[model samples]
Target: MTEALRLPAEKIHAAELEALKADDKERRPPGWALSPRAAVTYLMGGKAANGMPISAKYVGDKRLIETAVATLATDRALLLLGVPGTAKSWVSEHLAAAVSGDSTMVIQCTAGTDENQVRYGWNYAQLLAHGPSRQALVPTPLFRAMEAGKLCRLEELTRMGSDVQDTLITVLSEKMMPIPELNESVYAVRGFNVIATANNRDKGVNELSSALKRRFNVVVLPLPDDMEQEIAIVTKRVGEMAQSLDLPAPKNVSEEVARVVAIFRELRGGATMDGKITLKTPSGTLSTAEAIAVMIGGLSQAAFFNGGKLSAEGLAPNMIGAIVKDPVQDKVVLEEYLETVLKKRPDYADYYHMLSDLT
Candidate 1:
C-alpha cells in the first residue's frame, strides 16, 4: 500500500473497522458504525471472531475508553479534559471514527475560531445571485454532522473565544443550529453528537462556561500512571511514526526510549527514580508528547546523519529544547538534575557528558 504522509484512524484501520462491523451482533444506536461494545474493542484493541488484527490506539484504562464510547452513544456530548500529551485528541478521533465511520468531520477549536466557522457561512457570490437559498448556505462541519447524523470532533475546545465557544451550548442542549438568515434551524438526527477536547493548561484562556460545561459528559484522560506503560507508549508511537516517514530505525532506540522516559518522569515528578534525591522541576511541562517528539527527531538525525546509530550526542539537542522552555530558569533545573541525578548514575556517563557539553 502507498504510504500517506498522514492517515486518519478510520483509514489506517479500515480493515479492523470493517471486521468489527461484520463481527458486531449487538444492537447499535442509529447511524453508528459499530455497536458500543464493538467501538470500545476497536479503541482498546482485540481480535475479531474472524481473526482479523485490530490495533490498539489508546493504551490507558479500558474503563476510560468505555466511558468515552458510552457518552457518545447517548444524547449527551463528550468532553475529554486533561493536561498535554494525554492523547485526548487521539481518543477523540478514534471514537469518532469507530462510531460514525468518518473522522474527517472535525472542527478544530482555536483562539480565533468564530461563530461562522462553528455554525454556517453563506457563499457570498451565490448568496447575491440566488437570494438566501439553501444552495448559497455553506455548511460547516457542525451543520453537516447535524444533517447526516454523525459524530463531530472539536479539538482544543477551550482555546476558542468564550463567545464562540458558547455557540455549542445551544447545539448540545437543543440538538439544533439556527440559521437566522434562512429563518430555519437544522436539528440533529438521532446519532448526532460531538466529542470535544480541552487541556487544563488552557483552563483560563477561554474557560468553558458553567452552562456549556453541563452539556458534556466530561472524561479526564490522565497521563500514563506507570513507568512501563509510558515507555511502551513512547516506543510504539516513535517506531510507528518513523516507519510511516520511512526513516531508518536507530540501532539503540529502545535503550534511548527507556532512558528518555525515565528522565522525563523523574524531572517532571521532581524526584529521582529511587525517590532519594529531590530535584527542581523545569518550567516546561515536559510532556510525554514532547519526549516522543525529541526521540523521533533524534532518530531522524541518527538515521540520516549519524549512520543509524542513536547516541547521547544525537539526543542532547532535542532534550535541551524540550526541557528548557524558559532558558534562564529551566537551564538551572537541567543543570541541577545533571549534577544530582544523572552524574551519579554510572551507566549514564555518556548522557551526562553529552548534556554537560551542550549546557
Candidate 2:
C-alpha cells in the first residue's frame, strides 16, 4: 500500500460499533445498527456493560453528540456548527455508519457548489443526444441519499453560495425533489437525513436562509475543556494518524504533545489550565486536530533526524514553529504564556525550558 493513497479515516476502526450492535440490548430504530444511545456512545466513547470499548470520534462535547444523534431520529436535518478541527465531519461519518452502515453519500460544499450539482445534473454529451431523458440525469449523493433514506453529509456548508445552500430547503422540508425537465419527481424514503458542517470563524459567509435554518437541528461543537481531555484526544488522533500514514509508531512524545495541546486549549479558552491566568488568543484557532498534526510532524522530524527517538531537541523547535504562525503577535502571546504560567510550574521544568530556548 503506497502512502499517498491512504486516508486517516480509513484507519479509524468502526467495527467497534458493529460489536456494540451485536451485543446491544437496547431498542434500535428501523435501519439503525444501534439505538440512539448506543450510537452516541460510539461517537463519544464509553464503556459498555460487557466491557466492550468504543473509540471516541468527535472528542468534543457530550451534549453536542447527543443532539446530533437525536436529530437523525426526527424529520429535521442536523447542523454541526463549529470552528475547524471540531470533528464535525467525523461525528457525521460515525452517525451515518451506525444509522445506515454507510458513510459514502456526501456532497462536499464549496464556493463553486451550485444547484444542479446538489439536486441533479445532466450529462451534457448525453443531453445533447438524448435531450432531457432520465438516462441523462446525473444523480448526486443528496439524490441517492433521499432515494435510499440514508444520511447525506454536506461538508463546509457555509463555503457554498447562498443560492446553492438554499437548494436544500425543499429537499429538507418537503422531502421532495422535482425534475421539471424530465417531468419527474421523487419523494424521500423513510430514514432520510442530512448532516451539514459549518465553521463559526467563517463570519460573513453565505448565510443560510431562515427557511433552511428551520429545517436543521443545530449543535455547536466546542474545543476540549481542559488538559487531560485535550491530551487524550491528541494522543488518540496522532496514534491513528501515524498508523494511517504508514509512518513508524511514535513513542515518548505524550508529555510534549500534552504540553502543546494544553497551550492551544488554554489560549482557546482565554484562560490558563488552573484558571488562574488569562491570555489573549491569536487569530489561529489551534484546533485539537492541528495539535495532532504538529506532534506527528515533530515525530517525523525526530525519526528522520535522531534515530526515531523524540528528543526534546527536535520536538520543541517544531512545536514553536507550529504554534507561532504570526511572528509578531503570536510570539508576544507565547512569551507571555511561558513567563506567567509555564515558567513557574515546578512539575514541568522541561516544558518551561523548551519555551525559553526559543527566545
Candidate 3:
C-alpha cells in the first residue's frame, strides 16, 4: 500500500475479483477473470453474497461503467473519453484486471509513439546477425494480449500520432496484424480486446479517424455532477489513502471535504449552489479527484508535523496550493471566492483566516 496513485492491477482486490467470478452466472470467454456483468460490479461496487467487501472504484455513473463493460464483452473494443482526473485510466486498469486478470497489458499512447510500439519492434542486432526469426521479434503488449486472449489498455490514445493510432484500426476491426517482413500475421484469440482512454479536452485533437472510432464503443466519463457526490469522492479517496499509508486518521474533516468540493463545483460550473452567484472560473480543471489528493497531502503533513488533528491551519495552505494553478488570474479568482463565499460561514471562518494568511 504505497502512496503512489497507480497500483499494479494484480495488487487490486483478489477476493473481490473472485466474488465477481462466483456472481458471474453468465458464460465467460476463455481465460477471463470474470464475466462482463461481474466486471461491472467490481468497477461500480457491489457486495458479494458471501459478505466480502467490493470497494467502489468509479463513483460517477453506473451506466457508464456498464457501457464500457458491455462493449468489451461484445466483439467491439471500449474507449473512455474524458477530462483529466476523471478516473479514465483508473477504470481502465480495474476493468482489465477484473476481466482478464492481467492489468499489465498496456501501451501509454504519446505524441512520439510509433507502429513499433503498437505492433512489434525488431531486435536489430538479432535481425542482422541471426536472420529473421522469433528471437528478432519483440511483441508489444497489445500483440501479447492478442495472442493470450486478454485485455490490453491504451492510455491517452489520441496523444499518439494518427498513423500510430491507426494501426489499431486493423487490429480491432480485422482482429489481426500483418508482418510482411516475416510473411506472417497474428490473429487475436476469442476473448482478446482493447480498453483505451483519450482526453476530451484534447477533442478536435488529432481526431481519431472515423475508421478507428468505429472499432470502439465510446463511453464519455463525466465530472461529478453535484457538490455532495464530489465531496463523497474526495472523502472516500482521502480516507482510503490515509489507511493505506498509515497516515494519522483524518477527523473533523468532512466539513473541509464538503467545502473544498463546494468551491470546486461552484467555480467549475460558473455558478453558486443556490444558483445565486455567477462567478468566473479559471482554466484549471478543479475536479473532485484533485480535491482528494490535496486533502490527503495536507492530512499527511498534519500527521507528521503537527499532532495529526486535521486543522484548518493544516489544510488551507494546501488547498490554495492545489487550486491556484495560474499565478495571476487564478490567484485573484481564489481570493475573491474566499472573501465572498467562505468569509462569513459560521464554523469555517478559521479556514478562511488560514487561507488569507497563506495566499
Most accurate candidate by lDDT: 1
Pick by lDDT: 2 or 3, better one: 3
Residue-level lDDT tens digits of model 3 in 95-126:
89888888999999888889999999999999
Residues 1-359, candidate 1: write the lDDT tens digits: 98567889899889899998987999999989899999999998888879987888889899999999999988789999998888998899999999999999999888778998999988999999989989999999989999999998999999889899989889999999888888988989878999999999744577889999988999999888889999989988898889988888766788999998899999999999889999999877788888999998898888888888898888989999999888799989999999988998998998899998888
Sort the predicted structures by lDDT, highest score first: 1, 3, 2
State the displacement of the C-alpha of residue 71, model 2, in Å, after optimal TM-score superposition.
1.0
Query: Whole-model lDDT, candidate 2?
Result: 0.80
| Per-model C-alpha RMSD | 1.4, 2.9, 2.3
Candidate 2 lDDT by residue in tens digits, 7-62:
33323455676677777888776666678898888777887657878777777677
Alpha-carbon error at 71 in model 1, in Å? 0.6
TM-score of candidate 3 on Cα atoms, chains taken together: 0.93
- Model 2: how far residue 65 lies from native, Å: 2.0
For candidate 3, the clash count comes to 0
Cα displacement (Å) at residue 281, model 3: 0.5
Ranking by TM-score: 1, 3, 2
* Residue ranges of candidate 2 with Cα displaced over 4 Å: 1-4, 7-14, 23-26, 46-52, 274-277, 338-359
As for lDDT, the candidate ahead, 1 or 2, is 1
Q: After superposition, which runs of candidate 1 have C-alpha atoms over 4 Å from their true positions? A: 1-3
Higher TM-score: candidate 2 or 3? 3
